[model samples]
Target: MVQRIDVECKNESYPIFIGELPQKLEFEGSVLVVTNSKVAGIHLRTLLQCIYAKECFVCVLEDGEEYKNIQSVQRILETAFIHKLDRQSTMIAFGGGVVGDIVGFAAGIFMRGISFVQIPTTLLAQVDASIGGKTAINNKFGKNLIGLFHQPKAVYVNPFFLGTLSHREKSSGIAEIIKMAVMFDKDFFEWLSMQNLQGSSLLEAIMRAILIKKEVVVKDELERGVRMALNYGHTFGHVIEKETQYKQYLHGEAVSMGMIMANRLAVQLGYLSVDEEFRIQKILEKNDLPIYYKIPSMESFYQSLFLDKKNENHQIRFILPHNIGRFIPCTHLSKAEIMRTLEEFCDD
Candidate 1:
């Protein structure tokens, strides 16, 4: 069965189609499929069978977060230019988050923006990356430094694509689901705690997570208010990705650790109890997600934090949990307070 969620933006609204890729597809015009070599090998032909474009081009990029940079995006642009795709052409992101992000960015800038479709293969992308309109590429200074709010024409999520995901990838996606449950639905969190992530209930969890996200996005499309709450673990997760040069952890794994760090920080500020912190970590651990990291030097950590997209007025905005179903976005911490918090997590 197919599930549909509508994201209502002021200028336009689009549908997120969740289910298997249909035997038939609706392409606006000429089409280009952007993906990595690995995903192409596994699902490209199957995807091709569903498209009915007048012209089709496939550009396979090198797979990895480290490659989510301008260079990869440039390759996509070059392919579009060679194929002479115009503003009416459509670009399809046919892999995980990295592929989705870069392809989305390319479509946004190509000929000053075009339509794109998201066909997320990884669990992480299906639940978090693919649903949102945020598209970006990392810079030397930090992750997602360059991006645009380019909404996709549509998002097609086929959970069957997940069958090819490794155990690590599956666990990585679960971290995002955990983040949603912890921040918005205590009942959902309790329900997730009782289910085996590898069993039949997985898809239902993904859909529930998407439903929560749909409500948040529909309410705050530009992230000016309640939308900021969605950054629950990302404030620190993005830093971890940068400190490791995007190699040491999957995006979701770093997020798992970031959530633990955020919870610990929340506890320090008296916003969360020790018991609650432990509960969060326990759920993450149960899913085979990491709960700690040997943090880099205070200077390195500070440098990365300074570059976070969420910062403003020289203060880093932190999304800290207040309880199981709520969070507080704090940007008023003094430099000393920030330093002290970092010191607690710093490796000796």
Candidate 2:
């Protein structure tokens, strides 16, 4: 069964089609499908068969988080230029989050902004990254530090792609699904805690997560207000990704650890109870998500917090869970308080 969710933003509105890949994807103009070597080797042909554009081309880059940089974006642009794609062309992001981000950023700047569609192959991209218009490439300084808000024309989330993901990759996507529940839906959180997340249950979870994000994005497309809450674990998760140079853990794995650290802080701040914190951690652990990371340096980690995009006025902001299913963006905590939390995670 196919489920369609419409996301209406202030600047643009699009539909997210979930279930099976359409038999035919017709485009009026030329099309460029951006993907990675890993994804191309597996699912490229399936996607290629579905396209019926005036001109279709493919550009496959190296697959890995380390390659999510300006160089990759340049490669995508180079392909578009070589193919003579114009303002009327559309780009298709046919892989995972890194692929989607690169393709979206390139599409956003191509001819001063063209159009792109997301065919996110990985579970992580389908539920979280694919829905948001936030596109970016990482730099030496941080993750997603360079890019813009380039909304896709539409998003096609085919569950068939999930079957190809490794167990670890699936867990990575589950982390984001859990994030949505923890921040906005108490019943969903309770429901997730009980289920094993397979078959129909997983599909239901994906639809619910997309709907939750859609409601928030429509209200604050530019992330000027309540939308910031969506970065619940991202503030710390991005730091973990950067520190490890995006090698050690998947995006969702880093987020899993980030949530643990954030929950500890919430418990200390009296916003979440100890039992609630345990429940959150238990759910993550149940999904085989990592809940711990030894801090390399407390001082360095604290300084890195300021580099997160969510920070304002040099004060690091945190999205702390309020008793589960509710969240508040906090910026009033002192450095000493944050340092203490970091100290708790340091390995002896």
Candidate 3:
């Protein structure tokens, strides 16, 4: 059965179709399907078979976070140019978050902005990255520093693709679900703490997380206010990704640790109780998500916090749990207070 959620934006509204990839995705104009080599090997043929466009093209990129750069974006543009795709054409992002971001960015800049669809295969992309209309590529300074808010025309999330995901990939996706629960739904959090994260239970969690995200995005499409709450664990998570050069941990794994760090700060500020903090960590651990990261240098890590895109006015905004089921975007904390929290994560 296919479930649908509509994401209403100021200029347009699109549907998130949750189910199998339709047998045919009819498009009036030419189509460019961008993905990575890894995904191509696994599911490219299946995706191509579903496109009923006037003309279709494929651009398969290298598979890895390190390759999410301007070069990759250029490669995609080159393919579009070679294929002579016009503004009327639509680009299909047929992979995980990395492919979706790269393809969305490419489609956004192509002809100064065109239409694209997201076919997010991994759980991470399906629930969070693919829905937000936030497209970006990483640079030397930080993750997602170069990109724009280019919303896709639609998003197709096929749980069938989840069958091919490695155990680690599924665990990574659960971390995002956990973040949604910790920030907006205590009842969901409690429910998640008891589930084993398999089959029907996993699909239910994805739907719940997507619903929460849809509500937040519709309210603040540009992330001017309450939408900032969605960054709950990303500020620190991006730093972790940068520190390790996006090699050691998946984005969600970094986020898992970041959530723990954020919770630590929230507990310090008396916003979240010790029991609540423990509960959050326990749920994360239950899904095999990492909950700890040894800070190499508190000072350096503190300095890097400013590089995050979320920081502004020379202040790093932190998304912290206001106990369970609520969040607060904090920019008023002194450097000393943040440094103290960083020190706690340092190795003895």
Candidate 4:
């Protein structure tokens, strides 16, 4: 069965359809397909078949997070301007997270907002990025430092695209898959632990991962409170991305390591059981993820945490794990405690 998830927004809601992507879907007005060169090489034919618009165009960007910045976003804007895209015009974000992030943000700011559709090709995008309306680009300041929350008109998840992913990329996506399982559905986590994690089973797990994230996003579209829990692995993940200058790790790979560090920190804070901590590590290690990195100091990360849009002030917020299916928005840790956490991470 193709499961459908609905996410609420201020003006309206959107549908996330999971299963094999359909060859065609009916639509109105002009439609533009925004994709990356790598993805277009693989699926442009099928995408062209699926789009139903009076006029259709394709905008291809180079793949990679490094390209998901103001420069790229401007290209999309230029394309829209060249086409004289109107309010009735629709755009499809037709690739992984980077494509979705840039294109979705394009939909938000272009002529004050146009209809955007998400055709997520990567496992990470399918399970998480494509569903949420949050679109953004990275700057020298930090990752996703420039962005907006403009929800897609629809999100289509197709497991067929999984066939093209490399083993390393597949493993990277599994990290986010496992993260969703661990943060919102303990039963789902257990199910994931049993899977062989290669073909259809991996795809099924990916959809299940989306299910977990969808439920939370529906409740908190703007991330006022509960939805922030979806960031369980991202606190340290962001810092890791910064430290590596976004060159060393994929988003999901960094997140895999981030979640492990968060789970371990939870144990130190007297929340997680040692057994649970070990289980988390085992899951990451089984997928070949590293859970630790040495930093000269927490000075930059600490500063970044405060600057994080999610935080109110110098006090940083973290979505700490309470159990397999629960997390709490905690800002109780003093800077001293944070420094100690960094110290211990370095020592380990």
Candidate 5:
């Protein structure tokens, strides 16, 4: 069965199609498929068989967050240039979030913006990354610092792709769903706590999470206000990714640890209860996710805050939970206080 959700944005409206891939796919104009080597080798041929285009090409980059940089993006542009692709050409992102991000960004800037489609192959991309038009590449300074607000023409999410993911990848995607539940839907959070997180239950959770995000994106397409809440654990998660040079942990793993840190901060600020914090931690552990990290020095972390895309007027904003169902956004805690709270997260 296929489920569809519409994302209404001021600039463009698009459908996110979730379920099995249609037996045949149709498209207009030239087409280019951007993917990582790992994904291209495994699923590219299957994807190609479904699409009919006058001109079709594939560009495969090396996999991982480490390669999500200007260099990789340039390669995409070079491929487009070599093919002489015009504004009418469409680029299909056929891999995970990193591939989607770079491909979307490429389509944005190629001939001053072209059409792009997302065929997200990972759970993380299906639920979060593929829906939002927030395309970006990581900079030396931070994650998603360099990018654009170019939305896709459409997003195709096939759960069959999940079978290709490793155990760790599957769990990583669940972390994002867990984030949605914690920030905006207490009922969802409760629902997840009881489930074994398998089979049909997993599909239902994905839909719920996507629905929650769609509501937020429709309201604040440019992240002017409410949309900032989506960055609940990402504030610290991005820092974790940068500190590790985007290597040690998957984005979801860092986010899992980041949420634990945020929960602790919420407790410190008298927002979330200690028992609640433990409950969140227990859920993460139950999903086989990590809950701790040996953080860097206070000064290093302090410096890293400046690189955050959400920083306004030199004050680093955070999204903290008031409870399971709600969030407190744009909370600018003092450097000293942040340091004090982070001290507890260390591996001493």
Candidate 6:
């Protein structure tokens, strides 16, 4: 049977469907299908055929992280307005993380919070971004800097949709999955290590990641406490995205590199065993993820840490692993300490 998970937040409880996309959604309204050109070209017909609604509008945008800006969000909003979507109209994000975040954010504020559904096609979307209800667009400062905690009414995760994912894209999603297992479920991490990410078993891995995310988000919807664990690799990852200006690396690519940095920091802090750190490197390398980067300097990236929404009183919070599956946050580290940690792992 297809396993289902749900995130119970203060205001709402949303269900995450892991398996095939359902033939119909229980919510009824005019639906706006917001996606990118690449995904729409591949899945439009199937998505349209699956939806039982009488009215549907397909809103397509250019695909990639560079396109995930306020302009895109505005474009999506314009399309919804042009189509005359009212409060009853539901917005459906039918692609990867960027699509989901932009569409969900728009739906959240469109006429003061309308309903939205997530049909996340990428592994990254299905396991992490699409389920969290943290919808947003990037800004001049950093990735995902401006957004809202607007959860989807439902999330339909179809592994079949990932068939089109490039090796790089798959690796990006896998990094988030790795983060999930490493932070919340130790057994799941061991289970993950044993399995091959091919065929039907891929669905199982996705479900496991979704479960980890669902449980954590339910406890801390606004990322106050336990929810910070989700940023395990993201602290450095976001800086990397900003440094490169979101051009050279995929979101997951930057994250995989960020994990390498995190592991190195863990070892320096007496948290990660050397053998464990190296093993993590091996896994990421085996998956073809970049384990190192040639950053010019640590000053700008380190400076960006202060702007993190999770930071308190200018003290940047970090999520560090105690062991393979145990990660903790608010484990405050000093600026000099953080810079030294970055120096050790960050390449010249």
> In candidate 1, where is summed lDDT lowest over 10 consecutive residues?
335-344
Please identify which of the two predictions, 1 or 4, would achieve the higher TM-score against the true structure: 1
Candidate 2 residue spans exceeding 4 A from truth: none
Q: How far is candidate 4 from the true structure (C-alpha RMSD, Å)?
A: 1.8
RMSD after Cα superposition, model 5 = 1.0
Candidate 3 local Cα displacement, residue 94, angstroms: 0.8
Worst 10 residues of 4 by lDDT: 339-348
- Model 5 residue 347 CA deviation (Å) reads 4.5
What is the Cα-based TM-score of model 4? 0.94
TM-score pick, better of 2 and 6: 2
Rank ordering of all candidates by TM-score, starting from the highest: 2, 3, 5, 1, 6, 4
Q: Which stretches of candidate 1 lie over 4 Å from their true place?
A: none
TM of each candidate vs. truth? 0.98, 0.99, 0.98, 0.94, 0.98, 0.96
lDDT of 3: 0.92
In model 4, the runs with Cα more than 4 Å from the true position are 1-3, 8-10
lDDT of 5: 0.89
How much RMSD separates candidate 2 from the native structure?
A: 0.8
lDDT of 1: 0.90
**Model 6 / residue 6 / CA error / Å:** 2.8
> Distance (Å) between predicted and true CA of 214, model 3?
0.7
Q: Which digits, one per residue and each the tens of the lDDT, describe model 4 over residues 14-47? A: 8888877766776777788899999999999988
Greater-TM-score candidate between 1 and 6: 1
Per-residue lDDT of candidate 6, residues 4-98 (tens digit): 77778798888887777767654477888999999999998888888866588888999988989999988988988998889998999999998
10 residues in a row with least lDDT, candidate 2: 1-10
**Model 5 TM-score, all chains together:** 0.98
